[model samples]
Target: MDSPNVLLLLTTLSLTVSSAISGSVVEDLANLQPPSDFNTTIMKNCQHNPSLRYCNSSSVDLKEIFRFTIVASHLCNESKNPNCVHSFDKIDLRNRPKIAPLYLSYSFFWKYCPSTIFSIDLSNTSLKGSFPTEVLCCAQIQALDLSLNGLAGEFPIESFSPLTNLTSLNLSYNYFSESKISDSRFFKRFNASSFIHSGLISYQECFKESTSLTPSMLRAATNGFSRKNQIVRSEGVEIYKGTLRDGTEVRIEVYRDCISREKRQEFVEECKVLVELRHKNLVQVLGWCSNRNKRAIVTEWTDGETIEMWLSDSAPPWKLRLKILSGVVAGMLYLQENWPEVVSDIRIDSVLLTDNHEPLLSRFQVGDRYRNSKKIHWFGIFLLEIITNRRSQEFERGEAGFIEHVRENYPENLHEVIDARMKLPENIFDQAKHGIELGLMCTDQSISKHPGLDQISHMINKVYESCLELAPQNHKRSHGDGEEQQDDQSKQQKTTPERSETGDTVYNITCSSQWIESAPVVLKMTSSRY
Candidate 1:
């Protein structure tokens, strides 16, 4: 009986030992399934937690960011935070669970915690929220895309006042409506649609040829229309359902001018200089018109307009601003390096605003072209404007605010001049401050002190590199595409209704057409988009 009892005890002990070994093997397998599996287990197990998570908040594997981005969305709640689920070359938010809540708010890019990210794209995700006014968070963001989304409300123009280093932005297909109407007589309340009709919420005034937004003509010859561009009730510029030969919609620009030889000569000279221009940022002259009683310059249309007017009424979100600025810088850099003749004394006043707040480079006539040093100074001033949203010209000696004074006295104090947009998210201020430092370096008083466009571009690119440290992939636009552009705010954005099977899908606006007969030089009409 004793022997039998001992054998039974041994058998029980052996079984216990085997069970322990099997449990150990299972634990090892779970640990080796990659960070993606761990996150999946955590999310599925803890989907209903108070914080929407079921794991320890304290310890995070800071190393597996790359692996996490690939599968975040598949395991995460879709339709809520798309940008967070993916990443780009510059942004990475792997293993960082806390960031999940912030990115979900649809504002972490321009507002909330901008410093926490570098590149953010909430494009066409059917996102619904107020225009993120807090997008003015310091210039840490690089690229932004909120296009094709359900964005409501009049765009907050002043919100993007703080961004300085942004590069690419795409906000197409979103409705830009406002609650307030400055004009209330027509069946439609006076809104941005009065200026532009692409379903975009815009307030920037447009009429000039820029590189930001699509240009629209305000009026045709009407009893020698007064300087006032306000179109009377029925006299509003007409739009219809038509197509250009190339399948591109037909938009005309009418030129009606008074006989003035002096103005005509000036126009001719300006055109001569304009034709000399060759920069990626510069708009291509679609065509021109000069007649006995009229003179006009027809050029390729832009998407948006100047920074000032775009942000005049309200403000754009912060990330959008940065995207605009980056594009502007690329254009400016092109002018500063490849074509100094373009940027030097080209068009200070002609720097029109776009509906989207991007600055358009227009009227590039060689009027008092600056030397190399002055070129650098202007570049810095422009950079300061990009960063702070303050008028560099306003900062004469003895200016009131410290920002303007810095531009006056130090000129390199770009950081000091920054617009008080939203503060950078958390510690991201450090990067923003660094960006300002670079801006200051770019705008230093000394020519040698100032960074050239090439150097500046490199540094700006570095900002993108750093931004990748926080943001995820797919939250940024492709780099070096050279597609970023500004609008000619001088040209309004207006659209007319037309039936396209289901509903009104086409609104063909007429851009003002300039006839060669307008130019007294008797040049042949050889261009396509005149």
Candidate 2:
């Protein structure tokens, strides 16, 4: 029978079952005829055990019943476990390699069995690409095990917040990134071992000691301000790479003679705000020192080079570049949502990379007013920089600026602006064009026209997905390029000194030059002046 006829049959059977508890109606639903993928064992179990939650409903939703039956049929392999149909409350399909890439649909158990389903164990089921948010619909779910799978993405802690009853969760042995999980209230409820071997960076170690450090401790870490230990030095500011007694590497920024009282206070205030905000992509601020003659901020040391150096020296593949840009957007979005003021003065150098090329936003400038539009505009420029491998200031020499330059060449001559270092195939090239257009949309001078970071994130992710479809092709090319780039990076790192510098010079609203021409500088801009 066709779908409509099957639905009609189900409706009739439901009506008949509601009228009277007859064996015929139960049998009809159990042996739901052709085309319908109903699990006979599950339907028979429901008929036998009327105590099951959905079994005794007066009037069943035929569609929901159909979905439930389909899910049961797909998940319950009778050959493996003859008793699989007997249970609806707990699903344990562990070590089921045949069910690879399982589609845990939203309505699987949610619509018909939300209240009844308590535990789910899909461990080692070969699940991939993000947490199955469908599981969140089960409000009464107590234990969930999604371990030993290929699931990777930002762990959505906020979505799990409603599941107050969720007691046990095992996300170990996955490729998940540590986004905002470090600061979530739910993380505290679980044991640290639950996330072991998972790609998540432990934030517990970050908060063990006090955030307030004395000048003597800072000096000891940096070898009493030795010249060779210094990373970057500019007017009124000096940065030094330090190693603590416990072997924790840190970057210390010291404000020297030219600092004002107001500037010193702003530094302290910024440190306090940064201490509260924790995201994997943002450089973690470890501690700070403020005394009569000394004022400084200390942040975790990253081994990789700045984004500027990454672009300038080597030709990274399109996929790698997109991944880095995506990370940058993630970090910026976190800052925008949490503290809009810290979203000021975004420069290419402000973004530092890790050994794995993960982008971390190292610079933060707190502004007085919330100007998301300006931040969006800045991000547009940043996006263009990644796509084109050109400095935002370089466009200043042009009559229309970088935004208009791209707008003029978009769709037709976009290839002219794309970084020549990358040799993109047609499919990947299309995504680069899409990225250019997105950057143009973001760089609109009119504040009302600017897209929010969330919207930008969606667009970028869409492009990233498109590129991912051509991964096999892109990977073949990027592999050779990656080897070459790695060799170049090795050479570059030897000659270049690892530096972490934050600038104290406040810029006015109209200053369009590069914050620091050659060095990595975290430029601070007073919001009022900006």
Candidate 3:
């Protein structure tokens, strides 16, 4: 056959196949049975129990009924409560053994039937994964038993403040990671047995019984605040390495001398804020000393160095850098969501690395009012610092500032500004370009126009995942023949000018059309790089 006829025939066949598949899909969808409303049966049972106030009320909330029925259907064996009747007040599915473990979907407990449910017991249903923070929506709940499960995550201690009526909470026999309740009142309310075998250290255990240290004790620990014991000093704040009487190593942050009434009050307020803040990423405050002449905050000493040292001393791999960025995002999101105040001091020097290379936000200055835009802007500068390995101050005195410099050189001279220490592949370089664009968006001067942490988080995750996918390929390439690798490097440098001139233009057009579009775009870009 001629070329034109052959092409026409193939196109005709493709269209026919597509039409047939479309029709078949439509037919299948039409024949599908609609999901039965489980709420109907629940409502019918409620009608029989007139004694139940919410269930038999004149004005029934169908939304709440729908939510309750959905929750019940998942917990109950046959969509019926243990009493063999649908009930919204209490759901006790404890010790119900099954052939396989039950897996709760993410939406489970997202919206509880408030004022209608009082107790929830799912003690031994083999629940897996983290404790659902959505359970806090059960504001009227008196008793919640999630014991004897495989749930493992940070016990949301700070989140329980909303559960004012919670009289009983049994979290024993689980695999919770940390449960140092910031609220000391919880220690008096709940017995230690409730948290036994959960891998959770009580409040007193995490921070020794004493929450305060005297000035003399701190002085002795730090050798009378000698220069040899000093870690770092900035402004009026000085940090000294100290060891408590019990051999616990710590960092004592002494503020400016408290001579006036206002300074003393400020010291007390700062202490209150530090005591309430607790997360693995944030530096843990063990104790504080508020003397008439001196005020200091002591935090648990972390072993690793600061990010400034990490970047200046050596170039970490792309994967490790992405891990550090992700940790910073997680820590920032936690602070934004849980605390009323904002940490105004976000700098490269403020973040510390752990022995395992985990990033910990070490410095915090809680402001009286929250301004997310300021934090977002600082994070933008911080992200740029990580990408370029250049401090924001480096470009401050130039005609164009840091953000302006990035904007002027992005997609074209992006390669020049990227950290030279860490050589990047073509695919990873695309992600870096996208990151630079995100940083630009975040650093916009308009406070209201900056992207929210949620948006920034989504973009960062996409970049991190793209880097992770290419990590193994890069690893294998790194281990290849040394001479061959050197030859390849030489060839790459020789072609760099031509590639940047032509290949980068096409790549930028493709990427800009779908900038921050979706996860699929990220995957597509990673798979096929210019």
Top candidate (lDDT):
2
Say what the RMSD of model 1 is: 23.8
For every model shown, what is its TM-score relative to the native structure? 0.40, 0.53, 0.55
Q: Per-model C-alpha lDDT, please?
A: 0.40, 0.62, 0.61
Model 1's TM-score against the true structure:
0.40
- The alpha-carbon lDDT assigned to residue 322 of candidate 1 equals 51
Q: Residue by residue across 1-530, what tens digits does model 2's lDDT show? A: 22211231233333333334231122233444323434453365465545544566676654556545444433433112233334345666555554434435435345455354577777778888888877776667998888778889887778888888998777777898876565787776664435645676454643444278998899899999899899999998999999866566889998876467797787788877876555657887778998778888888888889889998988788777877877788888877777776753457787888865678888776665656676777787888889888785776654147667776765445556788668765445555655665566566443234556786676565555445434444333321132322233222322111122432222211111111232332222222211
- In candidate 2, stretches whose alpha carbon ends up further than 4 angstroms from where it belongs are 1-210, 258-263, 396-400, 471-530
- Superpose all Cα atoms of candidate 2 onto the true structure and report the RMSD in Å to 1 decimal: 17.6
Q: Across residues 477-505, which tens digit of lDDT does each residue of candidate 3 receive?
A: 42112211223432332211112333321
**Ranking, lDDT, top scorer first:** 2, 3, 1
User: How many clashes in each candidate?
Assistant: 71, 0, 0
Which has the better TM-score: candidate 1, or candidate 2?
A: 2
Error of 1 at 294 (Å): 1.3
CA lDDT, candidate 2, residue 504: 23
Q: What is the alpha-carbon lDDT of model 2 when measured against the actual structure?
A: 0.62
Stretches of candidate 1 above 4 Å error?
1-280, 303-305, 312-319, 336-338, 344-359, 393-404, 407-417, 442-449, 468-530
